[model samples]
Target: MKELICISCPMGCHLQVEGESVENIVVSGNGCVRGIIYAKNEITAPKRMVCGTVKINGATQPVVSVKTKEPIPKEKIFDCLAELNNTTIEAPVSVGDVAIVNVCNTGVDVVVTKGLSKR
Candidate 1:
């Protein structure tokens, strides 16, 4: 059995799950069906959004904020960050610009969350 707190909604339901596989798992203490789904996903294959800053050359600020375009496999996050750490973007980048393409081969782009202009 596994215990978890559902984060899929604002309710924050405490959930208890039993069974070895998703097919046979039983969930209790969920206020809504979303909690069941959240538990299953969290247990089977977890993912997370990556957000951080990378160095930028010639920008007003020395660094720019960036985030993964979509949630990536949790295990790939550090590898993704390592790639981002080695990256340096040119100034004049705009919001929504792609900072790193298919980062860490996860098929997700890292995009600029804040725009910066040349110094």
Candidate 2:
């Protein structure tokens, strides 16, 4: 059995899950249907949105903001960050430009969140 707080909504439902595996898990204390799905996925394979800064060359700012185009496996966050931290992009980057493609083989792209003009 496991206890978790549902983040699917602002209600923050306290949930109780029980089962040997994700296939048989049961959830309770959910205020809505979304909570059940959230609990199930949270237990089986959790994902998270990643946001960070990467170095920018020939730009007014030393760094630019970036985020994954889609949620990535929770376990791969550190690897993703490490890759991002080691990356350097040229100036005049535009928002929505792909910073890294297929990051960590998760089939997700890291995109620029803030555009930077050339210095």
Q: Please name the candidate that would achieve the greatest lDDT relative to the true structure.
A: 2
Residues 17-91 of candidate 1 have per-residue lDDT tens digits of 987678988999999998888788788887789999999999989999999999899999999999999999999
Write out the backbone clash pairs for model 2.
Answer: none
Please, what is the TM-score per model?
Answer: 0.86, 0.87
Model 1 spans with C-alpha error above 4 angstroms: 9-11
Query: What digit string (tens of lDDT, one per residue) describes model 2 on residues 1-119?
Result: 89999987789999998984668989988899988888888988998889999999999989999999998999999999999999999999999999999999999999999988999
Listed per model in order, the count of residue pairs whose N, CA or C atoms clash below 3 Å is 0, 0
| lDDT scores in order | 0.92, 0.92
Worst 10 residues of 2 by lDDT: 16-25
Off by over 4 Å in 2: none
Q: What is the lDDT of residue 46 in candidate 1?
A: 77
| Residue 106 accuracy (lDDT) in model 1 | 91
